[model samples]
Target: MKQRPFARLRAPRSLAAMATAGVMALALTACGGTTKDSASNSGSGDAGSGASASANPNAPIKEGLKIAFLPKQINNPYSTIVDKSGIDAAKEYKGEAKEVGPSDASASSQVSYINTLIQQRQDAILVAANDPNAVCGPLKQARSRGIKVIAYDSDTNPDCRDIFINQASSEEVGRSQVKLLSELMDGKGEFAVLSATANATNQNTWIKFMQEELKKPEYSGMKLVKIAYGDDDDQKSFQQTQGLLQAYPNLKGIIAPTTVGIAAAARYISGSKYKGKVVVTGLGTPNQMRQFIKDGTVTKFQLWNPKDLGYLSSYAAAALASGQITGAQGETLKAGRLGERTIGANGEIVLGPPFTFEKSNIDEFDF
Candidate 1:
């Protein structure tokens, strides 16, 4: 039996349920080639051209509209919180919404789900893509049929989606993690990044910034030793955490930018001899990391509210569907309780800064 909250933190995940859905998706996608080569960078496949659409800020939010959330994988704790909140937001706006995706974060697994969404004629498709380019073909087909594509949390390529609802700016999220680790390790030592999928757009983008941030004289004492991928699976992440420790005995810190990886790493460190010796910090849900903080496995970790991220994305999807604004730079739209947001260059809409959770304030948050 399963309980509420983050994936891999509570009871066994309902991976069996999601796998059944993913099989049908794969069947459908197999016909469409299900690979990055299925679509070319040339014009026809680069849909998400909302710039050509007109804006109407005064347009009333439509009712009974169908929107679907396609996460990197629905069987993830962080992604579950995000998609569930997005579904709830759709209800608030009088629209119908649901979440659908593969159980695994494999590169091509999400494409078939995108095809299903397109066939169902969803008014909007919100995706946190596994690979930025793998889903472009289906997304292009979706946009050609007048469906609004909004990339959230993890983005697709700019040409593949209309609006990207970023949890935080890529540079800030990446550089901040390095800065936090520097503070913990006193700016010196060897660390590694336990990431999700290697091709994960957001993960790679953030890691790039983290690498760049390290080049500055302020972080000369710190060296990034290795980057290990757990593919967003809890068991694999736990193993990767152990492997990292074995591979680098002098590793002073571990930065796991994915929620699954962070929780898994903290779980491993808490029960091992490395407890307290290796600092674990990165983007993680407060609920999942609460015990780690209390048990002294981790001193601090950071994340923007995933619920707020989904809520904001739902509204952004609705705004595009309702024609409130096109995905143009400087276009503005209401985001329910988050107030209004303006679209930035490249259709990016940032949620804001990350919040650090520590012993002092970790108990204040539930999810």
Candidate 2:
């Protein structure tokens, strides 16, 4: 009497045999189900498959995409760090990053790279432009072709590029350098500025801002005697600094906004008879200006970490590529470990304020 539930309803001899076969056939049919619904229910499903694939443009665009980071020059340490940080950022996204730039910071050379990136169909170009508007035409072409253009360290025209990654605000850099120079000179002296090429975007901006700030009553005693261009060349900067000394015999301080100019001036002052009489300061790096600082030729200088600039630039580029940001003014972005910063009106992201370095803390930073 311990019969199975369906076993009690035994079929007629032939019908029972047919029912058993029918049940077996149904079981097999269920196991070998080929319905669209079944296919969707299995491992290889169609649930949102088409929509998901089509919704993400960057997912496909990012695969095997290449980004180029073109600096003003390949030889300079500052640009070298830019190149390195970009490569590191690309590695995280499984992308390709390469460096292409002139060895001498020529505008024509940078233009060539812009053209090359366009021809290669690069995904994005992050450049530290040699001259503003010089590479605009090619960068505009890149934009038309769906390639994103970003400027880091220095910027091109806003209409030509998607974003500019500024190491710090132009005014902050200018004021910080002026303050450093004033501190080094004890708040009163005739000082000359050794800037980069006259057309250089960053150097000119900072110099102008510094000149305006020095006119304030708090800095009225400090006289900015002259603004000279060194073209960012070592020999030229050295000669320019020396020329400033000759041109202004009473010059008590020198502010070289260009790293090359600043370091060259420091070296020149250190090797000359005016070593202790004149203090050299500006945007030189810790490694390059360390000896001069130790020797007392450069008592103080101001700069944001160059590596941080590179790191932030790469992160911003990634954000743009991933469609996380559009480089719009007032948009805020987190530059890696450095906190959030709102994009400026110029489509630039300012890294933050610059810090002055003197004997007390110059030794703590390596570059």
Candidate 3:
């Protein structure tokens, strides 16, 4: 029996490494080193560097064909959903899909994990990068070693990966969360944003779009007083939330788009004396925010079903790895049980629309 490891895949770094190796292989193909072997070892630190790159792109994989699904954090519900999605896909594809990540979404830690997976010579990798550019170098090397790479939840440099499995349009995710906050505050009030790491691509993109959307006339009265970074640490998020309360005595609402930040903030608010005075809104798990919603600490919050996100991400990765979709714009692919997904111009696969959670329907979910 082939044993699977606990750690997830590292797609961005692996893809980046592959690209770098491809360039070097092209130059060294005539110098005794085979293009196939050099390409496979580009980013992967694996000793097996002489594999044929000309092997069928959609070759039949085996039961032990390893595919890693690395997220920002393994314990967070948001990332857990992504991990589960990849897991489900691996099961269907007759292979191993493992989940691994840094404890606090550290870029350096992610790079280290990528190096380890390359050394293992895993078949493929799927990742949600912490720092986009930082992961690219390692990913390029993984690609050089002939390992398929897929980016899901967040992207890396396009040249580094075969496909990027987007949960939803980044613009849509940003607009949706901001729209939820607008509704919670009735489009008028002093609101603050509690975001994740300052360098996180997904959060920054959403925040930028939210800021842009707020500038429109409809949200003219909604003042975004401050933006705080929690680094996705629970204690830090709690401290930041408490600070926000003290710093903005007149603040009416708080929007925390990152799962860890929002849940930590919600816990602080729910346990505080000022619970009813302020509204908490953002992306969170139904299970984590259930009590807050019931006690009126947070009237409502929003998040898409994470299990579904994971399930779809896995399918997208497998399809791309197997050459089912060419990772081209304007393409479409089928997601088992979830129906068909459209491939946008940037090689992104939109899973579906985002879903919201409130007191009225919070009990329907467990994670």
Candidate 4:
């Protein structure tokens, strides 16, 4: 017998509704032969004309459009799940979807993959940038070759990508983590952050917001002891967790906003004397954190459905590739099952709020 976690105030709407409602109708008016002008440009379509002036002007209105997803690293559990969901969405639209990226989360590793996708003439390239500026050059080249560039999960520079599919509001996520940690620590004592790579755009943004949240009077007794980077590696994060305990014997809690870092920290604490002594909480999938919660190592954690994030990103990419939306602020487009989404400032599309998972309900979710 398993218990369901209590519903948090920020819980997203039923994902079951999106999965069961089925895929949206594919608009086929944009199909058939490519215009000679578009075909003449090195087998890829012309950036200025084909991308902006297709007959349907909304895609993927046609079949055979190739969309590629580049995660920060290959074989990562979180990235694999998210990219596979995107592939499923592409198939629903009768288009081909490919996942390609380096094995490690290096800043420059994604650049070569972007260039390869451009040469392959992919219609769209969706990326989770390892570093914001490192991949901008290659992504700009992809755009020049008529490939619609969209950032998902993690973002590149604004000038490099046409749109960004953000998983959740960074400010909200940061504040929520602090709120959870405060409750676990009794609103006082010292805590540390176990983060991903130091240069990760999303991690840094969320950390900045967490720093701001700490300024509130309620959290004044909650001192931030240190910030440690694990490079999103399991072994490194475990070591960092051990180091945190050794350095700050009075540390009362740890907030790890990255999936990899949080899980690693939990694993370390679960097997050590720190278990029950230090509270661990942050963003994590239920499947990954279930045992931790059951063992009293982690009280709670929060995250949006990664599958839905990928699904929305896939549709957003196809919409741009088919010219349905131009990534403008205030432009709106429909995403299959998830409903209509608007392009917010900085060409961003928010999926929704993160949900809290605990022993009462961690068993209810599989992703």
Candidate 5:
């Protein structure tokens, strides 16, 4: 029997003020890591350099494939929702999906999980890496054992994984964050970034683009005072938001690129003196940011549907495990209901551009 595409696939959309003219061509860089098997070590190199890269396309897709999802941290609301989407996708594919990871978002936390997955002989491992370089060693070992390694949301070094599912264009997300904050602040005043963690690959990449975007003449009046780390912790983000307010008396706004950080910052501002004075904007789900937007604590924010991100990642993992496509440039995979996705440069598949959720359209989204 022919299989239909994965269920609950939705068309990707762009928000009114969020679409950009062009995507910046950002070069992929190699991250550092040491592996046990130095002879077959996969750290950073061309496609087909690793054992998984050379996996045969005709190889049987493991039945009831065990796919382990390792997010940065367990029990995180955002991670929980996204990982659930992956698990649902696994069920649709007749595969088993399990969630495993550290409770805290730290650079080295995911190493143990990867080692455990290797011991269990899982077919594929889907991860949103906490640190790009930290997980490469264990991931390389997993690949050596013919395990399909795919990174999603947050990515590891290109050499460590077969493919990476990017939630959105990093450059676009970073620029849009600055654009949204600049608009809210009327193109001027001090702003700070409340990021997830210092070593987070995606967070650092977006922050880099934000800094680049700030150099434009239109944003000359805008100043970035500080970039704080919340480690994707609710309390840490809340306290960081408070610290920003205390440290920068004239701060006009904050851009928290992580879902956790943004939500926590909003919660802080909603109950604090900074409410209505300091605008909060960044990546957050509609349900989490809905009240903040309705109460005027936050005017706008951006995010791709994380559930969809996980869904796509799951399909991609299945495709790889099934040996339908290699992680090569120009290779295409049938992404269930989301339609076909082509591999871009550096074995990356971009889900789509992010959507800005404002009060007008925030209610239209639930995830």
Candidate 6:
């Protein structure tokens, strides 16, 4: 139950807001709108700032507890898989859940949806934040109104959520990318990271570690010249990859730590003159990267199972709603099928570690 000194959750702090969403107030009429009865929200009491921060292992997951999944982008393949898994997991505990979000992965796009969820009075709202500060105010309002906020995949500002369901240790995810790229590039070359949104919490945290890792003497030969943001768009990321290659003709590698960015980078490199000359590696799904591996466009890449990330997050939401844990260090969470997991400092529950995929074994699994 002791907190590990190896890692500390990023301290809660205010940063400049990325953008603000216009707020609209609406009143729901049962005749044309959803009410509490119709929506099936059925949990309470421990969601406010004043709720008791204690764990009760025997508490039952409340029946009809309403939870919602708000991914960075509803249409994104990676977010789609993660959110669907959360929805299915909610059903296992008799909790009602629905997915809602903007089609674009933008900082302000998700704000209106969070406000809608608040108006609907859902029991919990699970989010994969696009920008930590942009969504902070709305999340605070949700929590103030007694809605449990659980952030998964990408985190919000630390103070905005009840607990964070981290897919893997942030530092490990970052350093691993540099390590993978080093081995692929023979520990010496010019490399640049093709990351997600510029304001993305998870992506930035991992990038920080990657920069730190590069300071090691073993990696003295490699240089990180730039960090480009794709905003998680397919076309833009493809263009970004092309631009990176043309701009840095001598660049030997690209690390894209986002699923969309990685796949897009691979797609561009596969058909271009850089196919065999540049090494592309980062986090991605097997289905998305399998073809690239087969064609030798990418020698190696890494990712944790996104489905497992969702399932674990859903169960953790259930635990918080059921009053089993209170987002405190040393508290234990019981995730169905995945078994029990302990909470660490700053209410973080890391799903596990990342896995590397290569030609010889890429065909063995699918997500």
Better of 3 and 4 by TM-score: 4
Model 1, runs deviating above 4 Å:
1-49
How many clashing residue pairs appear in each of the predictions shown? 1, 0, 33, 6, 1, 0
What lDDT does candidate 2 reach at residue 251? 94
Error of 6 at 132 (Å): 0.7
Give me candidate 2's TM-score against the actual structure. 0.80
What is the RMSD of candidate 4? 6.5
Task: Choose 2 or 3, whichever is better by TM-score.
Answer: 3
Off by over 4 Å in 3: 1-63
Per-residue C-alpha lDDT of model 6 across residues 1-367, encoded as one tens digit per residue: 2122121111113211111122211232223234234223322333443145557878989999888888887768788777777777888999988788887888899898888888787888899999998998988777766678999999998888889999999999999889889989999889999999999999999999999999999999999999999999999999999999989989999999999999999999999988899999999988889899998999888887677788889998888877888788888978886788998998899988777778866775555
Q: What's the TM-score of each model vs. the native?
A: 0.88, 0.80, 0.82, 0.87, 0.86, 0.88
- Local distance difference test scores for all models: 0.84, 0.70, 0.70, 0.80, 0.82, 0.82
- Residue-by-residue lDDT tens digits, candidate 3, 133-245: 77888787777676767787778777677668776678888887778888877888898999988777778888999988897898988999999999888999999999999
RMSD of candidate 3 to true structure, Å:
10.7
Supply candidate 1's per-residue lDDT for 302: 89
Ranked by TM-score from best down, the candidates are 1, 6, 4, 5, 3, 2
**Candidate 4 per-residue C-alpha lDDT over 34-59 given as tens digits, one digit per residue, 9 for 90 to 100:** 32234433323223222444333344
Name the runs in model 2 displaced over 4 angstroms: 1-63, 339-341
lDDT of 1 at 351: 90
The Cα error of candidate 5 at residue 230, in Å, is 0.8
